[model samples]
Target: MNTRPLLEVEDLRVSFPGTTGEVEAVRGIGFSLGREKLGLVGESGSGKTMTGRAILGLVPPPGRVTARRLAFEGRDILGLDAAGLRRLRGARIAMVLQDPKYALNPVMTVGRQIAEAHRAHGRASGREAERKALELLSAVRLRDPERVARAYPHQLSGGMGQRVMIAMMLAPEPALLIADEPTSALDVTVRTQVLAILDELVTARGMGLLFISHDLNLVASFCDRVMVMYAGRILETCRADALSQAQHPYTRGLLASLPRLDRPAETLPVLARDPRWLDDARADA
Candidate 1:
């Protein structure tokens, strides 16, 4: 197995030009990813999704993304042109978004959409793409692949739609997958199923996975390592099994806030905000 990281980021900063001044959404943060599951946990507006988007050059116009170093497979992402990034996006890296309702094409059949992804990279002929689409649908554990393939996005349930989205992303056979709250919209049972599929696929393919979500318990339980983010900064990075032993106050607060069945609390404590934490240069890894 290759010991080198699949992606490396250093001092990554993303900002938007605003009327008041430049608003920094993602403050300077650094991390590296190998062919393993790495979870990013934070509340909304903490810049979890933006970090993932910035990695793929999807920060949109007017939002400036800069980094002291940002590289994927030893290639500088900051230097990749439109054409180069296009080839790299879905082929070498892919992202699964929060909701399939918004991610999937409502009018296109599931199979055609998956086939389109496969063909977009010129990876296969039309027939081959179609075959791969069905294979991927099955790979995601969707029963009756033929029927699901013929169905439209709206015709499928939230779980099924998400499954189709995953199948489509898998069509490109990406080496890295950035899943931004992929299971947040699904029910508990379905969420478990979708994650199981993701776990199996990533492990079997030896792909690197960046799992982004706000669920602290979920990240601790599901990911190999967890990065706790607050105010666009990573306060701590620790092994999943050791999340309870996290030294950062923010991480401890998050863990304490989780509702537990075994030990119930009358009320969850409000997370105290500290401006100094934002300026903390130290990362407890």
Candidate 2:
């Protein structure tokens, strides 16, 4: 197994100016990723998404992002200008948002969008780009590539729309993919199907996958390693398969709060928080 680091992050932080004070969305956190699945699990506002956005240079205005180091393929991305960020985004690093309805263009046909993305990222164009679009659609495990490709965003089901988004992202053949709650909106069956496709793609393409989700169990099952995030900081990181053995109080609280079928409980316990975890720079569990 090639365990070389494909992406590196150090002392990453994101701040937004507030009326009262500066609000830190992502406190100083650090980690590295290779050609493997890394899951980030946290509450809605726990900085999981913020970390991804800062790394990609997608943080909106009034949102200040700083890091000691953020590099991909040994290249520092923090200094990338708008054009540099544009060139870096889809061609080298890609992000798959949870909702395809907002991610996909409602007016454009799916095939056109995918083909254009391919052409923009690479030198392929016209017939070649169109062919690559179909190929990508099929690669994403979507059936009837021709019919589906011709359909518009609103014409497809939620699952199909998400699949199309994945297909479009794959057009660039990105080395690192940030999948933020990619299957959260799908039904259980469709969720499984999409996850399977992602697993296959990651293994086949030898790319790094940064999976951000709130589903602790799902992340445990899917990813090789996991990072638990809280109030702008990573609470703990452990092998995904060994999440049940996590030592941090926050991670333990999270696991204890989940209802289990095998060991059923009358009520899930509320997670107890400690303020000290947020301030401790040495708290990497």
Candidate 3:
């Protein structure tokens, strides 16, 4: 069995033009991901989403992505040309975006979309692609696969749309799955169901998952390890179960800001920011 990491990043930076000058969205961040669930948690504008997009070659033009080393399963991501990146994406690596409505085609039926995804990467015959599309819908625990498959994107509920997106991403059986806030739009119960399906699929397939979200507690419970980001850099990383014990001031403050049911406070505590935390984020990590 191959023991190498599925993804490796070092000195990764993403920048864009600002009014004054170039503004770095993702500071120099580095980490390796194996075949396990790893959570990237941070507040809005912390560069969590930019980092994921950079890895998948989805960063829009005018955004500069640079790294000393950015590799996926031994291939240099930064060095890959457009065609190479396109071939790599959806086949070797798949991303489940935050909103399925926008990610999926509006005019196509769900079955055709999934079948297209499968056929695009897997090179399956028309009949085989359709069959696998239904199977994948069932795998995501979507009831009445046949009926759901025939429906359009707008016909499905939030949870059902998310499940279809997951099924679409899984069509190629990619080695790495980048799930960027896939559950953020769902209600609590539906979120739990989607997470359960993600867990089952990732575990069964031995796929590396880069789960990005702003929910620290949710990430702590769902992932094996966690990385806390702030101001475009990772401030701390630790076992997900031990995130409460994190020593970084930023991590601690973020945790304290959450309103816990057991702690019944009238108001949640506000997170206090320190300039030094940004300066020392790399060292802390």
Predicted structure with the largest lDDT when compared to the true one: 3
Cα-based lDDT for every prediction: 0.90, 0.91, 0.92
- Candidates in order, TM-scores: namely 0.97, 0.97, 0.98
lDDT (tens digit, per residue) of candidate 3 on 189-260: 999999998898678879999999999999999999999998889988899999999989889988898889
* lDDT (Cα, 0-100) at 63 in candidate 1: 97
What residue pairs are clashing in model 3?
A: none
lDDT tens digits, residues 77-171, model 2?
Answer: 99888899999999989999999999999999999999999999899858999999999899888889999999999999999999999999989
Clashing residue pairs in all predictions, respectively, total 0, 0, 0
The alpha-carbon deviation from the true structure for residue 155 of candidate 1, after best TM-score superposition, in angstroms, is: 0.3
**Higher-lDDT candidate of 2 and 3:** 3
Give the clashing pairs for model 2: none
* TM-score preference between candidates 1 and 3, better one: 3
